[model samples]
Target: MSLAAETREAVRARPFLRDALRAGLVNHSAAATWLAERAGLDGDSDAIAAALRRFREDLPAYETDPRAASVTMRSGVGVVDDASDGDGNRAGESLLLRVGDAAVVDGGDRTAILATGDVDVAALANALGRLAAADVDIAAAGVAGDALVCVVSRRDGANAVRVVEAALDAVPVDEN
Candidate 1:
């Protein structure tokens, strides 16, 4: 079986990584190399990358009912959707600017911070650093269009929102 057919368990175990991969934040080649060394999986980087790309593309379609979903493959080729051609090309993609104020949501065991409006990557980085400094355990982080979404320990959620706000406010506005 190809890596795509055999690697579902391994990929599903690292939910955060899967999210990052889908978001185009993780490099596919590097991930393939890691899989080879760590999981004893051997395959061409391009092939593995293609598989990962497919995995990412089909992921959202099954988000609500992932267990009931099945991977549809034929002749070792996966189906492609119109929104994503599965060509493994992201050359022309652009980041969306976040808008509005950050919101903190409590999810019992965890807290989530949803930030929007002019979201600066650097500011988000700084906010993450601040969270790290405070020893807050971040469960996950992702960029969804104009939103910078982050999940931290429930106790740290409100503080995390403030940290993001402070960092975003500190960015120097362009006069031009």
Candidate 2:
């Protein structure tokens, strides 16, 4: 494969690098050197940097779109394993989410943060990132239709709500 192809593949393998390049936040020279060593690209740094610049030119500029949604926090949620028959069906316990054998059921020590309306996977992704940065542990998270649900400990409910709200306020959108 050509050096340009290898360089592009290297950048693609690391999502943050691509994002940084799109936002014009990457130092091309430094990135090229790092990619050469880490990605095993047998090429000159100058050539790799030039390839990166070309790749950047083709990438859409990074942008975010604020979502319109109502955020609500519901306490007393819990996760139960073996709550499903592995057929994507819940065991009828007021389930908020069910995947394989685990389910987020009502009435537990956890809290569920629900965002409905104008919400999608992207909104959920943003919320999850903020939640992680805030040192909040997530039990389960999912998005269906216009609704997004994130489960966390009861103690982190209030802070999770704020973090989720801020995250949804400016969700990163794909311009591709």
Candidate 3:
């Protein structure tokens, strides 16, 4: 049987594997390692790679951002339709606040710090104020780093962006 057919069978047998793949927990090497460990079979790396290739080809592709630093804003309302990206594609909309230690993997060790969160404007403003009080510099804003992401649920979707923008704008920008 073909590798794609085999992978489909495997996924059908183990549905969790699909979630693992979506969550980025299992790639080609990882799957091989897992199978080798579980079945006590000496699976070659080449076989694992081929299986992964087949799996990818057989599955429906989902849109994802490759850049690690992207910020996404999503609404809480379940019924709100996603905005069109102008290319007949509906963008994946999710509100996420993320903070991470930014470091270049290929280059020498240089790093910057980042903090993010998806929350109500009042709460976000309060948090920002505290950070400002502690002397953290306000960096970028507006769909980028340090930018305020506003997501409106289907119920409150009409003024989501405006509300978020206003709250973010109220914060003092450091000109230094």
Candidate with the greatest lDDT versus the true structure: 2
Query: Please, what is the TM-score per model?
Result: 0.37, 0.90, 0.28
**What residue runs in model 1 are displaced by over 4 Å at the alpha carbon?**
61-134, 137-176
Q: Write the per-residue lDDT of candidate 2 for residues 58-102, one digit (tens) a residue.
A: 999999999999999999989998786566555456878877677
Clashes of each: 6, 0, 6
For model 2, the stretches where C-alpha displacement exceeds 4 angstroms are 85-92
Q: Give candidate 1's error at residue 112 in angstroms.
A: 16
What lDDT does candidate 1 reach at residue 56? 69
The TM-score measured for candidate 3 stands at 0.28
Q: In candidate 1, what are the lDDT values of residues 13-122, reduced to their tens digit?
A: 76556656655676878887776667666777677767777776766421211111111111111111222225533234321212232222221355556676655455
Maximum-TM-score candidate? 2
Question: What lDDT would each prediction earn against the true structure?
Answer: 0.54, 0.91, 0.40
Question: On a 0 to 100 scale, what is the lDDT of residue 53 in model 3?
Answer: 58
The runs of at least 3 residues in candidate 3 whose Cα sits more than 4 Å from the true structure, single-residue gaps closed, are 1-7, 22-25, 39-42, 62-176
